[model samples]
Target: MRRLACAPDTRPLISDRNHLGALAYCYATREEDCLPYRTARDFYARRVAPELPETVLTAILLVSPGRSLTRRGNVAELPRGKQWFDEGLPERLHHFCTDIAPSLCPTPPTVINTDGATPETVLAQVAGVLADAGLDQTAQRLASATAHAPRPPLDPRFVDTYTQLGGLEAFGHPFTPPIAHRGGTVQLCRLGAPHHDPAGHTRLWNPLGPGPWPPPGPAWSR
Candidate 1:
């Protein structure tokens, strides 16, 4: 079985496959505002869809409490010819939609109103459902990744760099969160073993500083 890995910073969502050989990508909105279908469709097409693997068979959008999945207009309906699902908490829907029936289900994915749940909570619940459905390996992988997901620093510049370089998996956790140093700010993160530097630290340059500056001290032999 392929181990489910953490979603990269560029995509703030989880992607995994169920035991039935169906692929799913789940996203939880950070804010409480509901997005219209057109906006959602465009965002998915431009930002999410391109990042999805060819194997993906469905897309799920999870939102927080007080939020809804609204149509583009009062009479507008969800765009046709796409396998999209909306739910407050994915685990709840898992029971009813065990089999992948994208082609058969003509109706749009159901819209769920999460009473008041956090993204972390939704992810944990979905992981549990996967475990119950005999996808223990995937469940464990998702749980582990969720637990160690990196928290972005407050600085917008650092956040941008982290997202660009890839999140926890690429840069590991921030050993030293963004902090001011040497007349500028710096963030020290440990890289994944595959890409860790000789010194075992990945130094992110302050976005506020000049461009293309070399490492402060002696450069490691590449």
Candidate 2:
């Protein structure tokens, strides 16, 4: 007898009331029912085809609640072989499904509900939540990104470069704080550097640069 260990399904549960009507249609319908209309291969086609309607594609995005319920006792016993089990795989999958997938949607949903609160207020609330979770750096970055201010706690070397580029006033603002890229950390200023032309947008500042600023022109400008 062979024992098989399967990972738990951590997919979000879909409620009939929560999903759109078109999605609900597919979710409620059984795969066997869909097979009569379309083959399994055709139903799971990646690109839009004459056979696959837009509504069907949208419906495919919804998690099928039935699959979760039906998979309880079914397990495949594989022949003896080296099996690799990663404890962290489930958490990574959860992050991708819950966090990354939503963001990758054509129109990503808003972070918070749109109540009477202003955009600034909502951002502040998010920052506060991050701070409460002991993510001080993330909270600071969120606040800085929203305010369009210089990224706080700048390194000693970049301080002079930031001041020379007219700080927040002339450079517009620090849209992205310094983050590690390629070989060195780079910061993105909303306005281009002084050497670039008028149409130039987004100046790149890297502490590891041969000089203080990135090269002029579109190639190195981004």
Candidate 3:
């Protein structure tokens, strides 16, 4: 059974409540209700319409010390597929906005890079972007709500909207999209629900566990 995953934001109404509403929506609809890994694989084969919002409705930038980039092996390390995504995906994502999304929206995405900026600076930038996007009220509400947001331990599979606005170092590793799984023959797949094999789960979870991360770097850091 194919599933459609959405990135929340349904209740874009109440100013103070909307940001959390959107997050709850995304968490409930996309992460909890829909299976993104399976859906992405299905998308690869079928070339279906993207389940997430089309266009760079917003561009969330994460800036960190070059050390953070080295630490995370580059933000590109987060996207699924392509061995080179770790090296190339950031540019690719940028291109997607500049080249691909313009056809769909009058306004381009609002980009935020918090490489050396403070939280207040980051928040101001986010507010500016939202204001430019004609979402000032929404941005104001989010600014307040995010300040009080109770952070959960990082889940590498879950994308953090806050991280996109900078402060990734404080949030721990940013959770990214997971690689999709393509099961074997149709007959072999039916023995149980089509899902990731054991190895696939390991690859997906490796970044989150305590250990030496593959490809090697600092042996003493979290």
Highest-lDDT candidate = 1
TM-score-best of 1 and 3: 3
Name every residue pair that clashes in candidate 2.
none
Q: What TM-scores do the predictions have?
A: 0.26, 0.25, 0.35
- Which lDDT tens digits does candidate 2 get at residues 1-222? 001111234222222122222222233233232323234223434332343222221111222223322332223121110010122322333333445434322333223332455557665765664554455675687676654344545444466666664454444445555667787666655443212123332123232334745535222212
- Candidate 1 stretches with Cα past 4 Å from truth are 1-59, 64-113, 132-134, 144-150, 153-222
lDDT of 1 by residue, 1-222 (tens): 122223324322334333211222222222233333345545555665566453222333344312332331222132110112234433333432433323212222322233476666655666665564455676677666654456644345666555654444444555545676766777666532222133433233222234554324321111
- Which of candidates 1 and 2 is the stronger one according to lDDT? 1
Write down the worst ten-residue block by lDDT for model 3. 184-193
Q: For each candidate, C-alpha RMSD in Å?
A: 15.7, 22.0, 15.6
**Could you tell me the TM-score of candidate 1?**
0.26
Which candidate comes out best when scored by TM-score?
3
Report the C-alpha displacement of residue 74, candidate 1, in angstroms: 21
Taken over the whole model, the C-alpha lDDT of each candidate is 0.39, 0.36, 0.37
Candidate 2 wrong stretches, greater than 4 Å: 1-115, 118-151, 175-177, 192-222
